[model samples]
Target chain A: MARVVVDVMLKPEILDPQGQAVANALPRLGVTDVSSVRIGRRIEIDFTGEADLDRAREIADKLLANPVIEDYEVRLVEGAEVA
Target chain B: MARVVVDVMLKPEILDPQGQAVANALPRLGVTDVSSVRIGRRIEIDFTGEADLDRAREIADKLLANPVIEDYEVRLVEGAEVA
Candidate 1:
């Protein structure tokens, strides 16, 4: 089996209200001295067997994330070698 | 300025409904052949001048992520070295 990792982040030019909200909530949660915060998304998927990495990237671009509003990267997780 | 990148993911023991929802939504959006999806959170913070990386990790542990329900990793962005 193989594990795929996906990281999704908002476009720098796009305003991130959710990120701002998390930043605002930080201090209240006893985490002081923080300057700023920007929140995004992370996803992991497990494949039953060897799969095409290129196809995974295609899925990421077409449906997993919004290319115009978000940026993403996909990689194979280490240490999942099959017997 | 220094940019701190934070990645947060659910504990292996916890069930990720949001991730499952995203996974289910994929095929509808024309992304087929996908098996699973697990979603988490990512955060980035900018620190003015040289700041303590240790303190940033502390904030990440205490506020940016829930230690009990989530795991996180923080790193400085590359190519931001000041002259």
Candidate 2:
């Protein structure tokens, strides 16, 4: 099986409150060096046949990512151990 | 500034309904070769100074991932362009 990874992240201009919350809470955990945090989605698509970047990109574009506020990158994972 | 990436995924045995939902919908998009889909979280932590893998791991373990069902990997991003 071939595995593809899609990483969907918010646009740089977008405000990520969830990440901010985590960043804000870090002080309580004594983590003072961290300046910022941004949270996104990582999707793993396992193909029954060959790893198809175009097909994966189509899937990511149509289903996984919101183009209005998010950006996504799709790439093939070579020899990546299954989680 | 340096960035650390933490990818948090559910254990292989855990049920991923969100991923399943996406996979089920793919057929409508003319995607049939896909065998499975798993969704997870990708977190980016930017530090004011150096990229600290140990600190990032601690934050992931304590707040980001549920040790019971999730597995996380932490790594430093070298010369990774900002999103």
Candidate 3:
């Protein structure tokens, strides 16, 4: 099995209200000294034996993320050995 | 200004309650056929002239993420023209 990491975020040109909300909430959470903050989503998947890297990317692009408003990337990392 | 994208996710071995909740909510959102889902965070920042890529990375590692339970990646993408 291969581990794939997916990152999904808003495009730079777009305003991110969700990120702004998080940033505003930080100080309330007692996290101070933060000048700014933006929020996005990350997803990690363990591909079954039949899935390859290309297939994983396809999954990310097609269903995992919205290409118009968001950008995403997939990184393949080595997984643990099967005992 | 340089555009930096940060992706924060739970460590693969750790159980992600947030991810699980999001996954469970997907079908209700009318998104079906998803076998699984793992939720995470993505942050994008436009580094001011003073902040370099390395500095942005430092911020991500030190403040933007919880190093113990989460892992993050920083990607530097070219920004638009200043003019």
Candidate 4:
């Protein structure tokens, strides 16, 4: 089996209130030296056949992410040897 | 500024309904080759002084993630010159 990871994040132009909230919460919890925060989603897809990165990217771009507001990248998980 | 990333995932024992929902939605979107799906969080923190990985881990454990049900790993973002 192979695992493909898709990292999705809001575009730089998009507003991320949740990330701002996290940055705001840091100091309240005494995690002061911290400056800013941005939050995103990680989606892991398991494939039973070949480790086809292109298919994963297609899945990410078409179904898993919103291209209008979020950016997504698909990559194979390390150490999934395919022979 | 330096950016640190904290990747958080639900424990294997924890139920991930959101992930399952995504998996279920895939077939409808014609992404049929996929076998399984797992969803998680990726948090990016921008620090001003130094890229303190330990501090980022602490923030993830105490403030950013729920240690009881989720596991998190901290790492420095690639290519944030720290000199």
Candidate 5:
């Protein structure tokens, strides 16, 4: 089986309150060096045949990510251990 | 600034309904070679000083991932383009 990984992140201009909440709580953890935090999605698509970048990209564009608020990157992962 | 990436994924045995929903819709997109789809979270933490893998891992373990259902990997990212 071939695997394609898609990383979907919020647009730079978008506000990520979830990440901000994590950042805010860090001070209590005594972690003072962290400046920012951004949270997003990672999707793994396994193909029964060969890894198809085009198909994965289409899936990412159409189903996985919101183009208006998110940006996604698609790439093939060789020997990925994740199930 | 240094960046750390934490990828949080559901344990292989866990049921991923969200991923299944996407996989079910792929046939309508004219894609049928896919075997499986898994979805998870990707978090980016920026450090004002040097990259701290240990601190990032601690943050991921304590705040980011629920140890019961999720597995998280933390690593330093050099020259990453994502915001």
Candidate 6:
């Protein structure tokens, strides 16, 4: 089995309200000194056999991520460990 | 500056409808992937001056992640990269 990890985040130019919400909430929780926060997505795909990284990248670039506003990176997680 | 990365995912036993939705959408996108998909969150925190990892972990455990139904891991990103 192959485990592919895709990390997707909004572009720097875009405003992330979700991240802003988290950042605003931090100080209320007595967690200070944080300058900023950005929230993104981590997608894990488990392939039964012959985990193909290229196909995973295709999937990420095409359907998994919005290339216009977001950026994504695809990589193989060691040991193909998925629960 | 310290860049902290927090990866949070639903527990294995918990149902992930979002991930299922993504998996179900893949075939329609002409992307055939064998097996399952799990979607999680990646939170990046950028701290100004003297990045402290333990404090970041504390914040993650307390405010960033729900330990009851979700599992989270915290690590320091090479550089404080948060947009």
DockQ-sorted candidate list, best first: 5, 2, 4, 6, 1, 3
Docking class of 1: medium
TM-score of 6: 0.89
By descending lDDT, how would the candidates be arranged? 5, 2, 6, 4, 1, 3
By DockQ, the best candidate is: 5
On residues A9-83, what C-alpha lDDT tens digit does candidate 1 reach at each position?
898788999878877876776655566677888878766666557767876787678998999988888885433
lDDT of model 1 at position B54:
78
- CA lDDT, every prediction? 0.76, 0.94, 0.65, 0.83, 0.94, 0.85
- Model 4: residues with Cα > 4 Å off, grouped in runs: A80-83, B80-83
Chain A TM-score values for every predicted structure, listed in order: 0.82, 0.95, 0.75, 0.88, 0.95, 0.92
Clashing pairs in 1: none
Better of 2 and 3 by lDDT: 2
| Interface RMSD of predicted model 5 | 0.4
Residue pairs with backbone overlap in model 5? none
- Candidate 6: chain B TM-score against the reference chain B: 0.86
Where's the lowest-lDDT run of ten residues in candidate 4 chain B?
Answer: B74-83
Candidate 4 is scored at a TM of 0.88
Which tens-of-lDDT digit does each residue in B1-83 have in candidate 2? 89999999999999999999999999999889999999999999999988889999999998899989999999999997754
The native-contact fractions of the candidates, in order shown, are 0.71, 0.92, 0.44, 0.85, 0.93, 0.82
lDDT of 3 by residue, B1-60 (tens): 555677787777878876677556655545444444567787866544533566556766
DockQ of each candidate's interface versus the true one? 0.52, 0.94, 0.27, 0.76, 0.94, 0.74
When 1 and 3 are scored with lDDT, the better candidate is 1
Which regions of candidate 3 fall more than 4 Å away from where they truly are? A21-38, A50-54, A61-63, A66-68, A74-83, B18-37, B50-54, B61-63, B73-83
* Lowest lDDT block of 10, candidate 5 chain A: A74-83
lDDT for model 1, on a 0 to 1 scale? 0.76
Candidate rank order under TM-score: 2, 5, 6, 4, 1, 3
Clashes of each: 0, 0, 4, 0, 0, 0
Taking chain B only, the TM-score of every model is: 0.83, 0.95, 0.75, 0.89, 0.94, 0.86
DockQ of 2: 0.94
